[model samples]
Target chain A: MQLTGAQMVCECLIREGVDLLFGLPGGAILPLYQTLPEYPKLRHVLVRHEQNAGHAADGYARASGKVGVAVATSGPGATNLVTPLATAMMDSTPIVAVTGQVPRAAIGRDAFQETDTTGITMPITKHNYLVMDTKDIPRVMKEAFHIARTGRPGPALVDLPRDVLTETAEFDYPEHVNLPSYKPTLEGHGQMIKRAAQLIRESERPLLLLGHGALISGAFDEAREIAERAQIPVITTLLGIGAFPGDHVLSLGMPGMHGQAHNNWAIDRADLIIGVGMRFDDRVTGRLSAFAPNARVIHVDIDPAEVGKNVRVTVPIVGDAKRVLHALAMQVDKVSRPDWIAEIDALRDEHPLYPGGSGGLRPQRVIQEICEATDGRAIVVTGVGQHQMWAAQRYVFKEPDLWITSGGLGTMGFEVPAAMGAAFAQPNRPVWSIAGDGGFQMTMSELATIVEHNTPVKFAILNNGNLGLVRQLQDLFYGGGRVASGYTGNPDFVKLAEAYGIWARRVTEESEVRAAIEEAAAVDGPALIDFRVEPEENVYPHVPAGESVFETIESPAGREALAWLT
Target chain B: MVDVTLNTERVHTITALVNDKPGVLARIAGMFSRRGFNISSLAVGVSETPGLSRMTFVVEGDEWVVEQVVKQLYKLIDVVRVTNLSAESAVMREMALVKVRSNADTRAEIMQLVDIFRAAIVDVGKDAVIVEITGNEEKVAAMIKLLQPFGVRETMRTGRLAMTRGAASGARRERAHTGGSAPDAEVVP
Candidate 1:
């Protein structure tokens, strides 16, 4: 059928099953927006900023296992999407960002709002395309979606020119993409799986380290099956929060820096580590040389590049996590390690993750109350910082994929917009945007977007009044010399939410924490709550950067002793 | 955990066949730069295949680095196949043009040196001769050193191009016009 490029975009989006997208339209993308109204099914949520749009798409992709779409205009509009795109790329979130570009003739001529969008985004994105002709739109769009959602998914970008959008062309969405080089291995090599199974069988101590890849591949059942059958305690990376039920008996919680002491100890002492779908990131490894010193790692990932990129792997299986786990599950024997479990429990009891400081409301208590009030069903989204770590540690994820945070990128200002996206993804569930004072203020403008769309997202500002994580780092490492971490001036979060025309509340006392959370949860539309927690509080069981997890500080006294030693 | 490599460094010649599309080279070069891989030389042009291009890159890195380079190259949507030709038995060649400052008095001496190096005089001026030589790195370097005494004015080189030996290799055979022995050789599947 014949269609203008703008119409073809809508048609391709519909064919790709993209019912909703987040973006802010500008001069270059106006043609597509003008054609948007014709397609009622393609719901467009206008965001306050292009960065927020990118973040929302990221959150949507994570919350719902579908490729999220974000649209922006050329130059600065597209540039704003860089942060969120990098964030998505780092976390392996499948998001397709469509951006407008200068006309083909003016591409290299520095036309108005013209920028090398593809050049700037090449390294960050999984792949990018610049459409010079209208005829290439459908094929490029098809390829973009395929690349974004398949095999160790990451962000994919398409830079569409204004001329192409205005030009008419024959539109035929291809049924299949002809990408010879893009084939992803979905099945594990039989020999590799068998060797991993044999390693699990021979080892007395085995740790099943699950990462975000498990959740991405929907390997929950397979993960649980293998963990239970092998009697291996499952430990998750930060992004791997919900891959396994936190309440399970064999669950060892998260590992690495800011991870549980017991989990870290378990890793340090394990003989065999069966890592599934997770890269051994520095944040998770502490000191690579000293991490899991006694363990032989059996790493499984879909990306072949990641197999031996960091720590050495005894048996590397490059395939989909679920498929590999299913295969390994068939070959594994049922075995129990009561001694190892007992040792881990003892470690947990001895060096527990306890909140420090005494003057104000405990942040951990607030997160626990929020989790309890919501029955652990709310989709929790957080920006990077102490609040993120607290949420990751406190929240008991009963369901898979209920927890979302900027893990790999450690991006701040991701909370509000990401929660808005998560709200759109799982509309029926209560979506919470939990952020520290610093991070919340970074993207608080997104509150307007939430109210505009009437997205029922509960915003929780852990009002610590400072960059808590950096402050804590300075306090511990720099001998209490705090600089630039404290916020001298800040807006009233509750009033700010009200100014955005949403229900708002402020909680000062620990007694009011639950009431405020429950009240916000009761609101049918966007809501916000500012919880003033302890200012000098810090996350314990801290593994100082580049140090071995074995040397994790379990309390203030331990931190003090380590400081003195340094 | 076992440490993968000793962080040893070596020069590696790598080749890849990629789709002949715009920005493909930029994507690859950008990846190498971002990953901190040092590229010694890079040569790219249309390959024997109608819609594919061949790129030869000489990079300095260790085994792990080379492994990552190959793996990361495969991640590019345009890149179809990558072969680490450094370790294989392959034929490597590079062409260099040496513009020697030669007068009538020294022109005969420069030509004799060029003849000994199996080079051709592609262009000649009133006081200079441009010696075009096609050989491996050592051979090119040797000729340049021999021409330096004659006051070489300028020099240009076409990085390096490499192809694996044996008729069954995946690389396309030399075209019939080149008068190579294996003109219609089939590539190994």
Candidate 2:
């Protein structure tokens, strides 16, 4: 059938099973918006900014395990998507960003709304295409989605020239992609799987360190099977949260600078480490040389580049985590490690985490309240800050992808729009955006977006009146000299939410936390609560940047903890 | 113990078969810079296949880096096949157009040197002779060194082009190592 390039794009999207998209219309992309109304099944959420569109798409992808779509016009609109695209790249989220370009004739002539979209996005995207021909739209669109959702999923962009979008062409959508270069290894090598199983059998203390890849590959059942059958304790990276149930006996919480001390200690003593679907980022490792010093690492990742990027690995299984774990489950012998479990339990009991602030309303209390109110079933999305850590440390996640945060890039302002996206992906599940004062204001303009869609996302703002994480760094490392981290000129968040026609509340007391959460949950549309948390309260169990996890300080009360710095 | 050592001493000549598409060079080159891999030289041209292009990249890195380079290259949709030809017995060559200062006085000497090196004079100005030579790196370097005293005014060299010897194709050899269903690029003679 002959169709305009814009119609072809719409058809291609419908064919790809994309029912929801986030975007904003602009001058160069008007043709797409005009054609979009014809496609009744495609629901487009208009975002205030292109960056939010990208982030919303990212959130949707993470929640639904599908390639989320975001659209924007050329030049500044495309440029704005850079941050969210980079975030997607860092965390390996599958997003397909469609941007309109200047007309083909005016592409490089410095025309209005003309930018090198493909060139600018090449590094951040898994792959990108600039379609000059109307006929090439279908193929490029197919390839973009394929690349975005495939092995080690990341963002892929397709830039359509304005003229190409308006031109007519014969629509031919290819059923199968023929790129010989883009094959991803899905099955583990039998020998490597056998070796991993053998290492598991030989080790005295074996730990399963699951990453975001585990969740990406949907290896939750396989992960549980391997851990249960072999009696391996599991520790997750920050983004690896919810891969194993937080209430599980073998779950050791998170491991990193902000991770539980017991989890770090377990990693320090483990004899064998089987890493699935996660890269050992510096935050998780602290000091690279001292990270899991006693463990012989078995790294299983689909990306070959991630295997030896940081830590040395005994067995490098380059395949999908689900398949590798499934194979290991079949090959490994069932053995119990009571001594290791006992040691971990003792460490967990001995090293008590910070119990939050004593006098004032604490951020930890708010997070715990929400978790309790939801029965740990709600999907918790967080922006990066002290609140992020508190939520990560406190939330009792029971399923895969329930706990979402900007882990890799630590992108602030991610929660608000991302929660909206998550709400769209799973309409039945309650979605909450946990943000700090510092990160919340960065993208509060997204409140209009939330209200426009009537997305039932609850916003819990930890109003500490300061960038709590940075303040803690200044306090601990710089002799208590306060800097520009405080939000002295902050607005009343309750009024701000009211300005956007969102249901709003202010909870200054810890006793009001649960009721406020419950009230917000009952709201038909998006709602916000300004929980004025204790300002100076810091996230504890500090590894002090480059220090080893062994140097983790459980709290700031002891002067001896600061003695190592001097 | 697993050998995860990163050796930064070796220089590898790698080749890829890719689609004849625009911005592919930028994509591949951007990937090299983005991933922190050092590129010694790169030359690309359309291959025997009508729609496919062959790109030869001279990369300076260890075994791990080269492995990553091949894998990263494969990530590009335009790229079809990537094979490291450094380990194979391959025929490698580069073409250079060296414009040397050749007045009437030094012109005869420059011509004699070019003759001995089996090169041809592609262009002749009143003060310079543009000599075209195609050979391996060492041969080109040697020819340029001999002409340096005559004041070599300019030089333009195509980085490197490599092909395996006889019936042992690099893509065929790679399939043996990969042990998967990834097919070899068909060489359309």
Error of 1 at A103 (Å): 1.9
Please provide, for model 1 over B108-183, each residue's C-alpha lDDT reduced to its tens digit, 9 standing for 90 to 100: 9888988999999999999889999999999999999999999888999999899898874644422111001211
Task: Give lDDT tens digits, candidate 2, residues B114-183.
Answer: 9999999999999888999999999999999999999988899999999998887655523212211212
Model 2 segments beyond 4 Å from truth?
A558-560, A563-566, B1-8, B123-126, B173-189
Q: After superposition, how far is residue A333 of candidate 1 from its true place, in Å?
A: 0.3
**CAPRI quality band, candidate 2:** acceptable
DockQ of each: 0.31, 0.29
Best by lDDT: 1
